[model samples]
Target: MASAALGEELKCSICLYFYADPVTMRCCGHNFCRVCIDHVLNTQDLESRVYSCPGCSIKFQERPALQKNVTLGNMVEKFLSTHRDGAVISCTYCVDSPVPAVRSCLLCEASLCDKHLRVHSKSPEHVLNDPSTSLEKRKCSVHKEFLKYYCTKDAICICMSCRLDGKHRGHRVEILAKASENKKKKLRNVLEKLVTKREKTEVRVRSVEERRRKSQEKASGEAERVTALFIDIRRRLDDLEKRILREISRQEEKLSLSSSDVIQRLEIKKEELSRKMRHIEELCNMADPLTVLQDPDTGDLCDPEVERGDEDIEENGVGDQDLGQISRISHSLADIIRGVALYVQDPADTLLDVNTAGNNLLISDDLKTATWTETCQNHRQTAKRFLNYHQVMSRRGYISGRHYWDVEMSKLGVCRVGMCYPSIDREGDKSVIGDNTKSWCLFGGQGYDNQCSVKHNNNQIRLPHQISSNRVRICLDYEAGQLSFYELCDPIRHLHTFTATFTEPLHAALWVCGGSIKILGRSSYEEP
Candidate 1:
């Protein structure tokens, strides 16, 4: 009986025989013979492109890969080896020859072939089951009778004699079939729940896998970009170093030439003084006195009244002007280094959020530009839409790290560039950029000549000078809680900086009244 049950477990539903090269299905975890499953899958309706598991009837949109069940195959092989000859039970009645048994009678304690089964008693007590070698298991050891009843209290099978007179006497008992049916009903309920849990788990697993794949892709892209950026930085630095060295050498050469000219003039003056001294010595010797007197004393006798001043010689040597030029170059180098460091931060590629744009604003197809239209546009009504002001916020928000982006505006327009929390008012005057406490902005007035101002919480500070350029750069350091604005001119000038502790993620906010503003830089929607 044990071997028969084990055989049933190892058998394939398609072949109705022991598994050969057993394979397990991923969808239903059912095992089948590899050749049998492949043949069945191949015969499925190709037009429909749907296949099902023969064991569980679970359908699949596409054919699933078959995983070889090595453990099951090994179990089958072991079973076959152990039961090589005993696989088919022989009839006890056919003692003269080995005849395969069709059924075994528990009441007779013997297996019967077709010929013997016909002569066997046909009674309820003579229970016949599939041919099994272990018939002793069907009888109760204590009562020596077939187990026909199940003790509910003890949860065991027993014979009629045990139920009536043995230790199980008077215990609540049921027919073996009824007990098995009740247990199966409970197990089916459990199986349904397990199937539901498995489905939900599969969904979660797929979601996690997708996130992992995206993370790897994003990391790879970032690494490549960073590598290229550093390479370019190194090249620029190397070029700058070489240029500075050349400038230093050129300055040194110019100074050296100036000093050389001064040295040559001094050498000529020294030779003339030596000749005057020689003439003076000859006069002292008396024979040349009359000749010296006759030679006519020129200005050379009085040391030639030093023509150039001490200042002239000093000027020919290294001076403050030369050092000052080199100092300025060094400062410029420092500025370039600082600018490159800032540039290394990820660009805030902000796209205007269409859902947040006011009805009077027209958003560009690329979502980078916003124009103030004279006529109202029919925009979808949403809670985030600005009903009172012609304003819009960026689709992306930042909670940490540094970001910078440029905004190019028409010189004739009045526009406000700023940062605002997502919870800023959407339908009132407070919704206007820089009008509420939740936002801060640099407001450019109607003309290029008009000075700009920084505003927040309805308070404004007018800048001393007009914004000289149409391009503005906005920088944010979320961790430091600093938001700064700069006029992108020949030399970028700082317009204003607001310092405050940020309590929520901030979006780049914009308000345009007369012309348009176009955002510039790569717009990344990734969250930090």
Candidate 2:
């Protein structure tokens, strides 16, 4: 009986259960469970500007100070030992040896073991709940009534008092299951939108990755071409100079042969005159002049052999005979050198091959010029024709000679004059003159930032400065394996040169799209 009285005194006024972690109000010294009073204070209307104690009916203009009541807490803990977490739920009626309770009777405010539950009435008044040691938690802490609904607007569960008398009285509410289902539907839409956004981000990332790859490729090619430009220029000039020197050597050799033969013949004539003179001296210096005349036949000795020889010598040799032939050689060599220089400075000997021309390329009557044509020509398609690219090759191919050609860029919209093997690709972007290993070129066009570029082996080099001259010159030394370029300015600037062993005969190529390139001239030099 004393235990029952102690239970009533320890119970919270709001939850109608044992005081749990009890706190007290300074205003009225109220002793209610912490959660029970907290919920009451939290749901109070600020607009009403009034606070009332649930247990004492004490009123306060502002919230009263709350402090932990250590003494009260100890008492509650000692009384609610059976309700502590981890304790076995047993029938309250079992005194000595309590059996585990399966059902809690809220109406009776007690837990019943299985054996007691089966005998108890199953009437609606019993109101059996899940076996829990704390029956007070099954109801509202403030109203002491069962929680039945979820406050949708506040997104919180509520009891009968909160639904009817609290701030959530007029708020949207639903059963717990229905509210959870509604929230899940909204969350699914958010998930779908996030998935769509992620997919779009992935696509953009791929696009950027592809661009990065292409950029790297372009940069690599550019670097290679620029390095090749400076290196090849020196090589080309050296090769051309050596070839010119070889030509000079050949001409001098030829001149030496003729001069040598004449000198040899003159020396033979002198030896014949010396033998005759020796014969006369032997006759004249002999104390045996009479013996000489008698022993060798006086008539033969007296015969005018010396006079005849002198006459022959005077008539046959050294008459304006420049045995040295130095003047003649010098003149010949000079002429040959001049001619070789011309071969590397002009292209009068180079002309276009109309058969290898693109259909849009208009060829001159003499096949010396090419211009872009609006209409396709009435010509048969062949492997040689530049069917796709706007370019043309020369009719002449060089194997072992020095050649030169010129192009005037004043009348051109785009220009690429260069040397290329006949086997160069004739169809793709790679076929564009100077863009592959088979070709080298001086490019002046609009597509490349309206600047200049040299292309070879699929690499490109942008020129540091724009071309100021309207004409450019190309020189190739096949024997020495070099190709060089020049700008036909007032002083004729050296542009660039490429050095390589020519594995096959090369043809002059011109890339003139929407413009024209005429073979102004061509010249060639080989061992004469």
Instruction: Identify the candidate with maximal TM-score.
Output: 1
Please estimate how well model 2 matches the true structure, expressed as its whole-model Cα lDDT: 0.73
- After aligning candidate 1 to the native by TM-score, how far in Å is the CA of 267 from where it should be? 3.3
Clashing pairs in 1: 349-522, 349-523
The lDDT for every candidate, in the order shown, is 0.81, 0.73
Tens digits of per-residue lDDT, candidate 1, 328-431, equal 56655554443333554353467889999998899999999999999999899998999988999999899987777789987767999989999999987788
lDDT of 2 by residue, 1-528 (tens): 454676678888899877777899988888888778866874552235478899777888786778889999897665455444435567888888967676788867888887888888888867787677767766777777766788878877788789988888999899877887888899889978986886688567657766866677767875675467435544545655565566666656765765576567668877975786787677778897567757553365446884686566445543443435435334434332332334322214677888888888888898888888778885678888887877889987888778787777634478888999999887888887877889999887655544677778867777777767767778888878888887665335566778898898899999887788877787664443
- C-alpha RMSD of each candidate structure in angstroms: 8.4, 26.0
Question: Model 2 segments beyond 4 Å from truth?
Answer: 1-348, 446-450, 525-528
Candidate 1 residues lying further than 4 Å off, grouped into runs, are 1-88, 93-99, 151-154, 162-174, 269-310, 313-359, 362-369, 376-473, 478-507, 517-528
